[model samples]
Structures are given as C-alpha cells and as structure tokens.
Target: MHRDFAFIQTAPDRVFIGWGPFEQSPMRKPGRPAFYIADFFLDDPHPWRHPAEWEELTFDALADRAGDAPAPKIEWERMTLADFQPIFDSARAAMRRGDFNKIVPVQFENGHLVERTDLWPWLFRRLAQLPSGMSAYGYSYQNHGLAGATPEMLFASDGRGYRTMALAGTRPADRASELLRDPKELREHRMVVDDIIRRLAPFGNIEVETIRILELPGIAHLATPIRFEEIGIERMSFVEMVRRLHPTAALGMSPRTEAGERWLREADRGVKRRTHGAPFGLEVADHRALALVAIRNVQWHGDAIRVGAGAGLLPESQLEREFDELREKREQVKALLGLRASVAIEA
Candidate 1:
C-alpha cells in the first residue's frame, strides 16, 4: 500500500515536523512517495528510523496553490565580516599542517525570521525554477520552512545501477574558461572526483564520464558523473551507500583516506560542519533512490533564519579568492530571498 511523507530537518535526527503513511519504507523497501518531500542531515544516523508520524495529505500543485499569498515578514539578524575571518585563518592553518587537503569553511549570516504562511508556496515555486542539473526542495509546517536548490547529486540509483556527480571547483560563469585551465581549481575538482571514485570501488568498475563545466545562475563548477557498473546490492542497503559516501571531500574530506582521516581527526578543532552536507534521498520507485546534498539550503530555527555558505580550501588556495567564492555563494541565497540586509566578510 502507498503512504505519505514530508519533513524538514535541521541536522542529526530532528524534524521541524513530519507526517507519513510512508508509501515505502524509507530505510529499505520504500517505494515512490505520494508528493514525497523529505530532508536528510549531514549528521547521518547509523541505525535508521522509519520517521513516520502522521497520515499523508493531498498536496496541491504550486501554480494553482499560490493564488496570492502575502509577502514574507523578514527580520534580519546581527552579524558581520570580522566574525568570519577566524574560520578562514584556522582552515588555512590546518591545510599547511598537512592535516587537510581541503576544508569547506562556512559562515553564518543575519537571520530573516519569517512570519508568514506563504513560505511553503514561495520556497516550492523558487525551487521549481532551477533548471537542469539541479534539485530543489522545501519543507514547512507551523508556518516556518527550510529549503535549498542544490547542484550536487549525492547519489541516485535505479534498480539497474548507481551514479553520482563529483561537483567541485566553483567560479562565476564569466571565468569558466579560466577555471577549466587553472591548476588550483582542477586540482581541487580532481580531489572531489577521486574521493567519490575511491568510495564507489566496492560497488563495481566505475565509468567516469568526461568532466564538464556546470553553469549555475551565479557560479559554475567542474562536474563529472560516475556510474557504477555493478553494485553489491544483496550485501548493501540504500542508506548503506549513503554512509560509505558521505562526509565527502567536497565538504569534509573522507576519513577513510590517510590524509582525510587526519583532517577529520586533527584539522580545525571545535568548528562543527556548518551545512552538515546532509544527504536527502527519495525512492522514485520501488528500489530506485535519488539523493541530493542539502548544501544550499536556508533554515528557520524558531528564533532565527540561518543561511550559510562555504568554499573548499586546499593548502594551495588563495585566501582572497576563496573568500570571494564564499561571498558569492552567500549572496546567491540573499538575492533569491530578496533580503536587503545581506551581510559579508572580507576576502
């Protein structure tokens, strides 16, 4: 029998709210969702939970549903550039220490504690606008919401095989050619690809498609799609694939590699992952799953609207360029929300 599902996650295993007559078992046999909307956390739980709470509802399509909801009530938070400098410095130090090959540094921005019922329709419509190669999602209940338009696909599998993208090396589209040639950007992009390939080894012979330039509205990335020829599905569960691939080098270097292990253990102490790089997955059909990274998402944590952005830093990275890259990321969200009081840190 089919069921319903919806959720907005912060990190770890807490939900803003959820309702489910889960059409498919989210952990194992979950089939396609009935208007399925779920979010995953970077803090993946080893032993999974059903997370089903209430019965499903008849969700309306965006065009018909958004008849004329009022504008969102936005309240800006207090923060600035001086506050984010330390994070960059620390990440740089770790790279120099040989403890990290790359570190994604994040900065928290001013909140836009929205008080409105229109957030759901707004977020959904905004998400729908993203073009090919991107996935958008939002979950709102009790009048608060969490949403993102993410370019990186964590993993997607149709009963036939498994595939994912190695997306890294960000630059504005105007610099696309420069990015493709730059040794530093190429090096960083390779690291992300290698991490994905290394982790997928157990699955099968990996066929890596030619790396291409992925152009987004504000930035472009070097993206490579990797397909596994054979998967040891009998011995693995869908979530198990998530466990093996997460904390990816695009965000956190994988601990399984010698260098990545040290980075995970010895790199910048006390700074938890800001975005957490959550892996939100869906069963498009029975046994077919598609998961995306929730990196570009914004959150409303009761008291504040939290937006964050990061750039992968390598020992060879330029602080000024890295800083500029992160600013672009943060600003994209700000512009998307039409918030006037955007905040920034120096490059």
Candidate 2:
C-alpha cells in the first residue's frame, strides 16, 4: 500500500524521503517547513514543480516493489553539449550595452546510464566522494530515475529566521586569490549580494556577514551569508519566501527589468531545466526547513539524463574561457559518476 517517494541524501548516513502525491506548499502543515524540488525554465512562466509529480515507494518499499526481473545495467554513453554559444554571445552584448550588470549562462551536458544494481546501493557508492558543498540525490518514478551531486545551498530556515547565501564567481581553487582583484568575478558576486538584499528588504530586518571564498574540489566561489528576522507569518509561505528569491542573479539576472528578462529569454534558447539550479529542501521534525540550489545535479525525464552547468557572463568574459569552464564543470560530474568518457570540449 506504499506510494512512490523521492529520496535525497546530503551525506552517506543522512537520507530523507518525500512521500508523495505532493499536494501544495504554503497550505501544508502550519509552522512546519515544506520539503520539495523546484524547476526554472526559459519559456514556462511558472515552471517550479516541487517534489516532482512522481509518487511511489522507497527504502524497504523500493525493494518490495522490485519484481523478479534483473535491473538493467547502467553505463554512461556518448556525451553532447547543449548549443549555448549563441546565448553567450548575446549575453555579452547585453552586458556591453549596460542592459545587465551580470548574466549567468547555463548549459546542459547529457548522457544516460543503465543501472545494473539496486538504486540506493549503487547511488551510495557513486556519491561517496562528494566535496564539501556538494550533495548526492536521486528521484525515480516508474521506469525513470534522476541522480547526482550539487554544492549550492539556496536557502535554509534556521530556528530563528531564514538564511541564504550569495555564491558566485567561479575559479580554480589554486588561483582563488586572483578572484579578489578580478573585476568581473567581484562584480558578479556583488550583483548576487545586492539582489538578495533588495528582495529580502521587504520581509523584515536583515543582516549580512563577511564575504569569503568557498573552495570546492575543482573550483571556488565568492560566498556571503545573509539572514532575515521576523518574517511575519503572513509573508512566509513558499510563495513569499522562495518565489521572491528564485532565479537569483547568480543563476538568473535581477531587477526583473525588461532587459534582464529579455536576456534570460533569449539566452536560454528554449531549454527546459528540470532541476539544475532548481530548489530542493528537507523538512525537519523541529519545524525548521533547509533548501539548497540544485546546481551540478541531473534528472531523468522519460529516457533522457543530463547534468546541468552554467557560468556568469559579464562584458569582460572571454567566450572560449567560459566554454572551458562549462566543460570542466561537466567533466567533474562525469568523473564523480565514475564514467571516463573520451569527450572533448571544443571552441
């Protein structure tokens, strides 16, 4: 009698499930934080599907659901990059015209794997090496499955109030110091910080802590943490708290101005992002909530599987270098999946 469920793991021992037929967010139990997944797409005006539409069983339930047939063997096959050069070109033009201070351009590199083992056991082994900020996750319904690791924490509801961070400006960890004086990276990071402040100002009192560098296995980003107090129950539900801050300048441009909107529309090139940079959260028994940006993650839709990646585009961004960054990001994910594909990134 168990329905389908979504399971997420931040660490090897920490796993939680989202039992489904995911109804509504704001209307859920009062004082309790709702847990779900969110999606942001180019054409879809409102494309956030929290907890996904799949409802099934998990853990002991999945084993019970598994029939006598042996599961298919999973192997990562051919790699291909989403056509994003044109979008990058346009974003750079926008930056030059002062239309947008900073724009983040995203790309998807897709490949599929046929699982030879049970979902949970295989996933545990695959995600065993996640770096400090990355998280391992998997969601399946019927014949489809989505799984990967992401390092961005979009927002979390601390016991006292709400907390989120501005993560931008990617660079190799060895050369992270160069980011300090790099105008482009600093400008991009500032845009994220300023936008977070503007959106949270209306909620209540706000506080911002020191800005530092967040180091990852292969890359690093400028990070700043912000908190808001007295959110006032009336303004709290998912609509007020999440919708307002979604598509951050780090992921999408800000001010919701015509130029910024146009940049996203034209730059996106009609790609539908399933969970990359989307929001995912966990519900705490204590009534507190935790949410993280779904970047560096992949999803399964029917038969397709892909890992999502994006880079900030400023007027000074070099096209080839940005492309390289995307390749490096995608390669990092593939390596984690234990796939050694002979994929080469081109200019």
Highest TM-score scorer: 2
| Global Cα lDDT for candidate 1 | 0.60
For candidate 2, the TM-score is 0.79
Summed backbone clashes in each candidate are 7, 11
Once fitted onto the true fold, the runs of candidate 2 whose alpha carbons sit more than 4 angstroms away are 1-3, 9-13, 19-34, 41-82, 114-120, 231-235, 284-286, 341-347
Q: What is the lDDT of residue 196 in candidate 1?
A: 82
TM-score of each: 0.78, 0.79
Can you write out model 1's per-residue Cα lDDT over 1-347, one digit (the tens) per residue? Answer: 02222443222222222444333333443442322233322333232333355322222334234444444566655444566667667767766776656776555565554453345555544544455656665554454456776788777774567778888888886877677888988988898888888887866778899989998777788989888756554634466777777757887762345665554444334434433366765443355556677777777655556676767877777767777787787667655654444343332
lDDT of 2 by residue, 1-347 (tens): 13445666534345565555554543345443345665564223432324433332333443344433332233444333335677777787777787876777677765544533434444445565465667666565565566767766667676557888888888877888877888888888898989988988876888999989888767777889888775566435444566778878888885457888776666555666656676766654364566667777555555455666888887778877788778777767766765443343332
Worst 10 residues of 1 by lDDT: 8-17
